[model samples]
Target chain A: MDAATPQLRVKRLRAVLQSVRPFSSPKIELEQYHTAADLAARILLLAQSHGDVAGRTVVDLGCGTAMLAIAARACGAGVVIGVDTDADALADAASNLRALEMEDGVDLVHSEVGSFCRSVAKRPRPAGVHTVITNPPFGTRTAGADVAFLEAAAALQPQVIYSLHKTSTRAFLLGRAEEMGYHAEAVAEMAFPLPKAYAFHRKSEGSVAVDLLRLTREPPAAATAAAAAAAGE
Target chain B: MRLVTQNLLTCQVKACMDTAATPDGGFLSYPLKVVPDAGGLKQVASPFDEGVAKSILPRLDWAALRKTAAELGVAALPEEVPAGAESDAGFLRSVYALVFDIHLEEGNLLCPHCGRAYPVRKGVPNMLLRDDEM
Candidate 1:
């Protein structure tokens, strides 16, 4: 990883920042999209289970600041596209990546998850992505964020999709996945705090969360073929 | 959980009660308070009953959390997390508002397991199960 963007670029960034700095408010005004190493580890595990991350193309939906993108590349993703509706979050993510010289490792795309999925669907096959990783919003007021991303990743025909969501959202997410004819092979859950995220907990209450989730389809015979061709597997 | 939702979902625990109850005989009791956090002052309302927030908060659906809290006919939240708004405060913040700030002083949490009713008294939900049900 080398400097991909200019240094000294001062601007508001979004959620990806929380990953860089947790337990502190972002100095710049913008939403924080930070991923914890704990969450990133889950994404990496998904990639490891499927194959490798270093050279594969990964589409990150609701990719708040490319935290997973950076992690994926570090693990082995060849090219990581971080997609989000927030330009500021994307810009911030880009800046963070640039600062870390991870620009070559990832690309930040400004678009809604739905539109991004459609665009990816239009691209040529064998684009080097066998996986789609994302951390979409789980607030029900905004329904379908995860579903839309999953549909989009499905369009890309990836072998697996690793999305982050609250454990409480399992019913909706799993229900929607089944309704859409998508297969969910497993759900890995645990109690974890999302970094840089201040979830007020009552002294009287205990809280737990599943910061990461991996929803993958079996590698298409085609994917195995492609990967085998690429790696001489 | 949203404060608004917390007000409704909390069960009265001291009565040796369960958090959720059926519509016929169930009631909820919660006490709410708002305080400061790293980012800003926060509001957390939980079921006055200790047993309530613990049992139900983990199970709350994010959407219903909004609907139950905003039962007073509040406006729909903005598309993006607006500054100074509840939703913008991140997931935990939102959950705090839903679970901690809003008082379940007079509500009942519907049990996902049984359709029986639990009642609230003095901002506490009586989630105690009957001998037969237990």
Candidate 2:
């Protein structure tokens, strides 16, 4: 495979990502949406270019079917942990990993995103998660569910987080990010195609404008102080 | 799941979520006991990468990994990571194999403090807590 060009690399990555199995029976309440391979590939490629994916420990909160998790591994992330509340989604994720010969690169954990983050926070040692990439529920069913996912990702203390959110909520999430001590910006805009997976949908297909929001953790107080001292010298 | 992932997991029970440690000790929730069913433990060799191993070394809880490795009877690890272990090729290979190559296909991760069992099936651990437990 002559993936000398970035375009070729993305093409190859997308080809593999297309095989990731999506939700068998997506639940409306959980907002289990299948992330298109193209979008996932683009997001992961962007993260990789930013030095956030390769050799970095990544956590995919709300990892339905492990789309982003698998992509992160494909991008050379050292360790990828996919946490989902739904066991069936995780089953599909496992199968996807096996079919792609990527089973060893990622681990699936059956837990709600918030619960998993809480556990990581309580551990005596840091979980060493460096990046988090998630396409969370868009908050149509449950109010604040999207923010809840963001909160969980932040709790993991990752260096950077790439999350998908409705572009409409950009202002609110950016504010929340600031409150949480993260410097956030929308890095990419993409349309998330929604195939009719639920009964409530009026149309057979729809698309929502989403932003690939990147949240970088600000330097800790101690690190900032040390940097300031060094600069003074 | 891989032992590398296990090294990061902890009991998610509500009680366990609020505190860093049990009153008795600071390490109760983590390094969950790995109890593999008959023929559940397996290994698939992966290419060793010294850079990746060294990068992950700082994130690992050496004590927890040693305890978990000991419990599973997989490999022996020193009480402490030796000096310059990061640069030592032999040390990196063993650690990489132990953490990344081993897999728990079917088992239970029992929380030492709460006795709550998180079942591992088909290489994925179900860490979800029941509503009441949550």
lDDT of each: 0.47, 0.85
lDDT per residue (tens digit) for residues B1-134 in model 1: 22432232322222323443345543332221222122332333332433332333333344444544455332343334335443232543444434445433344444333334444322323343344543
lDDT for B94 in candidate 2 is 96
Model 1 residue runs over 4 Å out of place are A1-19, A22-33, A123-128, A192-208, A219-233, B1-134
Residue B9's C-alpha lDDT in candidate 1? 31
User: DockQ, in order, for the candidates?
Assistant: 0.01, 0.76
Identify the runs in model 2 with alpha carbons over 4 angstroms from their true place. A1-3, A219-233, B17-25
CA lDDT of A204 in candidate 1? 38
In the range A103-203, model 1's lDDT, one tens digit per residue, is 53355544456544543343222223467887665544356555666676666566677776668777777767666556663345555443324344234
Each prediction's Cα RMSD? 19.6, 5.7
Query: What DockQ number belongs to candidate 2?
Result: 0.76
Q: Report how far off residue B83 is in candidate 1 (Å).
A: 58
